[model samples]
Target: MHLILWRIKMSNDNLFSKAEIKYLIKNKDIVIGSFGLAAIILAAMNYGILYLIPGIILTIAALGMRGYKIYKIYERNKKIERTRIKYNFKKIKTMDGYQFEKFVADSLKLIGYKTELTKKSGDFGIDVIAKIENKVIGIQVKHYKGKVGYDAVKEVHSGGKIYKCNEYWVVISNNHGFTRQAKIGAEKLNIKLYDIDDFAYLLDFK
Candidate 1:
């Protein structure tokens, strides 16, 4: 019988992505004992050394082992799929500032980014610190019901410099979006801004 081996890399972010686990399970090695035990049971029964009842019991046990392995793989796949679903972020009409930051972090995880929430006491206006493709990003989440102004942009720009991140972004979950001054400030500071629609577009949730 042919043999195969599969190993998944474990990390602090996650054990494996949904795609990786699916690939591994697809090539999972079939236990050799299935054919070997069945053949031995048949041979012993034919030689009259083993009774038919014992042969049937051993054959069932071998098959059970094989089935159990397949079941475990199925369970693992289900878990990974569920995790992927959790990252899907739809329209948010009402969420607090902290909730919005956590929601953004979940979406980033779907796209292969690891995120951490900064402490509220001394975060320097940055809410989320994301590491994406070896690039660190400082994000400020403003879940305002009204338009965000230049001050929000200024805070994120300052936070980015203090955190020493490669990139900086200000995301606002506001219907009114940003003011003209805010846009101009973001442009001058080279900071990315994401309004409600823009935020969804970035995550491809739209």
Candidate 2:
């Protein structure tokens, strides 16, 4: 009975794995590439037929259809990637607020920074304490489903000043990415801001 239960668990695990999602993405890309090539060929044939307006219109329509198909495929791939990351994150053992901090600390350690998980509540925006090159660095980690705007960055900068640390880092888990204004704010405050994609890269997720 135990053997049967173990086999069932293994089968269920394999059924929900990301390997299938990756295979589907590969097939979708192949189909998109073939459609793109066909559209290009049709456009080339229609280019010389300046008088055949209908043919030109049909070629343009085909190109647009291919573009829409490719866009949908890319969107689906992004969703799959996000789901995979979320699943991996859930598997790590950490509390709600501590999860992002733990991930940052692990990544920093991987990059040769000595990290300490702090319990200071008044940290305001700061999360992790890191030591590098004989200097203490304050890290503020934010896990959001939306964009990390100027306010979040400003809070981290202020926390950095309060802590009197050598440097400050604001790491956000989710965002539409940084805007030009947010980048300028970071520059002015001399603080480092990392978005979801940048955090993933630093953690060697991809």
Highest lDDT model number: 1
TM-score of each: 0.54, 0.50
Task: Judging by TM-score against the true structure, name the best candidate.
Answer: 1
List RMSD in Å for every model shown. Answer: 15.6, 17.9
lDDT of 1 by residue, 61-95 (tens): 65676688789767655554454345443445556
List runs of model 2 lying over 4 Å from the truth. 1-95, 204-206
lDDT of 2 by residue, 62-98 (tens): 5676678789777656755674375465443344657
What is the lDDT, from 0 to 100, of the residue 163 in candidate 1? 89
For candidate 1, the lDDT comes to: 0.72
